[model samples]
Target: MPDRLDPKRQFLADLFDAAVAAADPRRILQDVLPPPPKGRTVVIGAGKGAAQLAQALEALWPHPCEGAVVTRYGYAAPCRHIRVLEAAHPVPDAAGIEAARVLQSCVADLGPDDQVIALICGGGSSLLPAPPEGLTLEDLQELNSALLASGAPISVMNDIRKQFSTVNGGRLAALAHPAPVLSLIVSDVPGDDPGAVASGPTVPGRPAASAVLAEVTARGLELPPRAMAFLQAAAEQAPAAPPPSRSTTRIIASAALSLDAAAQRARARGVNAWVLSDAIEGEAQEVALVHAALARQAQHSGFPHPAPLVLLSGGETTVTLRHKGRGGRNSAFALSLALALEGQAGITALAADTDGIDGSEDNAGAFVDGASAAAMRAAGVDPRRLLQGNDAYAAFDAVDDLFHTGPTGTNVNDFRAILLGELPDG
Candidate 1:
């Protein structure tokens, strides 16, 4: 493909690359590996980054450790000692059910001398869909779809998922019983809560079913009937604290770390960079509006931060699918941001998922700038209509602005950078 991005666009893209590189398992996972146990070390995990974590673990550990980890299709990393299983993500499927079973079996029949290293990261919630007893995978699948469309934040969705899951909320650790579990996590959630990542498979503590159900009702999320009924009954029963499990969690990589890395890169290039937050959340478009306001302020008023500055933020954003659109939250944010800017000059922004897949699309995300809307019109595309239909992919593709960086092998949620100042003339 022709190089369509200018130097300013390339600068934003470079920042994103720096952010993702900061979370690479091979670079960050080695120092956190625990000492090998005397009996056995079982490796089990699920997420977009699980396979990469397995590959890193296999390379770092001297002693032999064997187990399996599940990742999204097309995300497998080769490992000699650890098995890498592929499964669906953001939605549960039969393959995910089997993957969950494999993970469960991997940690079972272990002794106190044995140890389990959990390679946890984002997307594991969907990859390991072990439905609770009395509920079927179909029920969990239905719930998963509803949750994704409900526009709820990831943490809220995970709270509800913990109620219906067999493998989440530290049950995986409890299942490993006598064997201690050490969860090496790449956090994708806001606030860097280790328990919120991958629904805390190794970390203990499940909120009461009643509380989860209440939150669901408050959010107006319509779960499947079977799952809803189960939650109702479980809610009535005495809420029991989760059984104590010997599990230690370490957040090896997170959005904060990645954002810091991006800022450092910006500074090295002689641009002042200010990180807005590493935990920004809400509807993608709404969040984009806030970012647009900031960019405008910095560009026109020179308040908050002066010109030639880049504002950085990292966190997961949601896209409530009101239309049958073909774009993820990152793309949606870019589109909305373009509209909000109204062709304002001297402002360029990039929004992308660090995993190199935004929602279910092939592209990681897209770039937007002062001219994005004008370019869409010139291409005979209606940017407003596409944005309303939740089809930001078409908007960016119309302008040849869709950013692709296939499967980065690790994830730390969204990476957004907005640069204020015009690109220098060649």
Candidate 2:
């Protein structure tokens, strides 16, 4: 793609790289680590950034460190002491089931003098799949698949996740009783809710379990009978585990910082870059329409920013699986944006997940420019039709424009950039 002959493509790619660098765990973890305790220090985490966060902690601590972290397959970072385990993401697997159990056991038998430093980020809820008692891993997997298919928002999804996890919803941190816990979270969910990131393994979840179950039922998600009963019983029988205040939770990386970094880079290159927001969320296709509309306005009227403007944003987007396609949220959004742009000239946009995988797909996302529509037409591919089937990956793949950056070791959520250049010689 580097030789695609688009003048703006390289710059856009650089902008994305800058954003990823800003949220890299290795750099952010350098300053936020709690001073090494005199006693044993245990490192634990689950997410796309878990391994990277653990590796950074191992590098900085003054004494010995031990524990484990679970990340999506192809996302593990090399570590000498901390165990890095790979697992399926956006859906849980037996490997994650075991890892979550190990995580719980890792914190067990700890003395009051011990310290636990947990690293968590996006994709964590799926990475650490520990089902509560009375529910099987199959039950949790079926529930997760339902949630992903339902296209529900992260906030709602996490609320339900915390209800069934043995280690999540503050249970993991609660294990560190007497032992102080320090959690360094890289925010992917909007508002940076600690309990939602990786299902809040170290932090308590919000929106009471009963409320989450209600939201899930409202969305028509079908949980396994046992899973459904467990959640219902949990809500009816047990009170919402009071949110945990015991852990020292700090957000060291987030979408806002990454967007700021990208915007700064754009400005350095002499372009007018504006960050729309770091908290944007909604259905991927719907959100793409809004962004496309904004880009068109910038092209016609330059209302918010001038020509040569780059509208940037970061946040998670949902994709409800009606037709059951392979594309992730970013690809779906890119395809929708491309169709809406309708081959408009002097405009190019990129949508990608900062963690380097947009859902379960190998490509982080895709790039759509003024030529995208034309290219698809030439290949006899109908972008709108593919989108109708929820097959965004196929649409983008036909054009050879899918952006692939494997396991970026970070998760600040989606990053989108709409670069609208000056109209040709007006």
Candidate 3:
């Protein structure tokens, strides 16, 4: 590839790749070792990165091990001893229910002499769904659909999920008590709060069910009767998560680490890299507008430094789906920013999920340029109308700018970068 290609475009792509690589399970699992116990070691986990993490453990662990891990469909990796199971993500399915059963069975026989390495990451909460008492999988499925459509933040959504699942809310750790657990996490939540990541399958902390119900009700979400009953029962039995014991909890990867790696890559490519924040949260469109304002300030006043700088950020932003949009929050943010930029010259950006799936769409996110408005106009696509419908993926696809990278097998939330200058012409 020639360096003469638009710097704004090239820098954004490079930064996204750097962020994805930083969250790769192979790289993050190297430092996670506590010497295999004398007894058998069981590897059980669930997430988009669960299979890959299991594979890494199989490759690196010195002792004999056996277990199972469930990952999102098509995200599984080859592994011996640790069986890899595929399941639906963003929704609980029969396969997920089966995998949860297998996970429970894997730990059922372990005693204090045994060790359980829980390879947790984003999507695990849904992937390992074992509905709580008085709740059926059908009820869970309906509640999950409502939450996904509600556009609640991941923290709140996971809080709600923890209340309905048998394996979440530190229940997994409680179930495997006396068997020293080592949780190696790939954080996808803001602040890398273990309790919020995959509903803290292994970590020991959780909010009460009433608090979760209050948030859901406040958001105007209508829960199914069975789900409501389950929540009511849970609220009555609401107990805080147990204190953290000797179970070693380690955050092997997170948005901050991914953002830092991206910054270094931008600097290596001779672009000044500035990470705005790793804990960004809010509605996707609003977040995009805020970032656009900062970009405009950097362009006009150079308060945050001159052009040729790449602004980087990592965080999971939500999209309240008022309309029947066909895109994820990352793409929504990109489209919102593109419209705000309104053909401003010498600027290009990309927003993508590190897990390689933005929302329910196949593409990670989308790329936008100074010419986006012009291109959309020429294509007869109204950006405002699309934004209103929450159809950013369709808008970007029309412009041939959707960035697709199938299932990177990791999730650290979203990676975004904006480039603010043109490269030297060839």
Candidate 4:
């Protein structure tokens, strides 16, 4: 906690804070809400940001709207009118199952005069899980564990989830038939597909079961037999009726918006901020290599941008999970970049999840600079072994570079910034 006061580290932390603040549900909820309807407004959602969105909506809306929202435990925000329920994330639990049931009931019997505002965001898939009739909570827990370990992208995982969920895949919206559903989403997946965010409980469109099964086989995931049968049966069955046409969705906050905000912050400070992309996605270490190459290019040629440059990107990266120890994609990317840089001067980088949780780990992510290598070696940390074991958290923690901020209340996926210092003239 003491070294967290370091000015250089604080600068990076400040940038991350700016990015997160930009995506706050309270900030985005205002000025975007539709006019008050004549009947009741039923609010419901599931995600890491759902509770915060509910609290913000309650504060912003002039009329009374009642409903329930589920969020990852410890991520709940205070709300007087809306009910805030906490549950497990990255995996489903009984609490989440019950919450999903309650959320579905919120939309039931709602008329066209009533409205439903769904606060959807990252982590909702696991936090709002509700399995089909034949599936038990234990079964869902197993499916979640395998899919997470298989290293499939979030979109793919969500598609598989939709296949077995009685509450996901627009089923919830279908239940709310006559009501007008406005899904306000905070996207954490690449391409910002609402149908994938939180498994699209209110948004329509689910990938074909055959496609998801193919992915499972390709990824070699150990799926439950019951789950497999469910998918096969669903695939062979005729497509269900279309989802509620009255339901509409809007992305209130996303990685792109967060990246833009970070770039703007850099520009305000006179630094040349170039946003590389807001949709970069892949294996964490592999993406680090690309980022390291860009940092090196800016350091050498300054092509596309000059010195005093900060390259920013926003997206969710994956970890293959070779080792059992605690580590997340952001930390993995930072460690890999440090090794690739080999303590090269005039460059520093920070990688963190804006939600303040990276994977199942406690820390958000970490920072790397010219001193990272030496610091690790001085601390008797084997960067190569740790990286090989997918234990970047250990490397960063050894060097006191682990960035921890508890839960930031909202999520917009990962935020990475690489600062390229000006080269000394010959």
Write candidate 3's Cα lDDT for 1-426 as tens digits: 222435466667778888989988778888777787888888889899888888887777878999899999889899979999988878889999999898888877568888899999999888988986676788889988888877778888888887787778777777777799989989999988887888887777677878877887788777778888778777787475565444668899999999999999877877777899998999999999998988888888776767778788888898877888799999999999999898688778899999889988899998887778678878989988998898998899887888888888789999999887754343
User: Which window of ten consecutive residues has the lowest lDDT sum in model 3?
Assistant: 1-10
Please report the candidate that would top TM-score against the real structure: 1
Each candidate structure's TM-score, on Cα atoms with residue i matched to residue i, is: 0.98, 0.95, 0.95, 0.96
Q: List the residue pairs that clash in candidate 3.
A: none
Using lDDT as the measure, the top candidate is 1
lDDT of 1 by residue, 1-426 (tens): 127677898999999989999998989987998888999999999899899989988888899899999999999989998989998988889999999999999988999999999999999999999987788888988999989998999999999999888889999999999899999999999998988999998999889988988898887888878888998999999988778689999999999999999999988887889999999999999999999998987788877767789999988899898889899999999999999987698888999999999999999999888888989999999999999999999999987899999999899999999999854343
lDDT of 1: 0.91
Q: What's model 1's lDDT at 425?
A: 42
Worst 10-residue lDDT window, candidate 1: 1-10
lDDT of 4 by residue, 47-92 (tens): 8888888988998999988999999988888889899999998888
Instruction: Give the residue spans of candidate 1 off by over 4 A.
Output: 1-4, 423-426
What do the candidate models score in CA lDDT, each in turn?
Answer: 0.91, 0.85, 0.84, 0.86
> Regarding lDDT, does 1 or 3 come out ahead?
1
Model 2 C-alpha lDDT per residue in residues 176-243, reported as the tens digit of each score? 78788888899998888776788788985556667877887788877778878887787786564464
Model 4 alpha-carbon drift over 4 Å, by segment:
1-4, 422-426
Once fitted onto the true fold, the runs of candidate 3 whose alpha carbons sit more than 4 angstroms away are 1-7, 237-246, 424-426
Question: In candidate 1, residue 79 scores what lDDT?
Answer: 93
lDDT for 105 (candidate 2)? 84
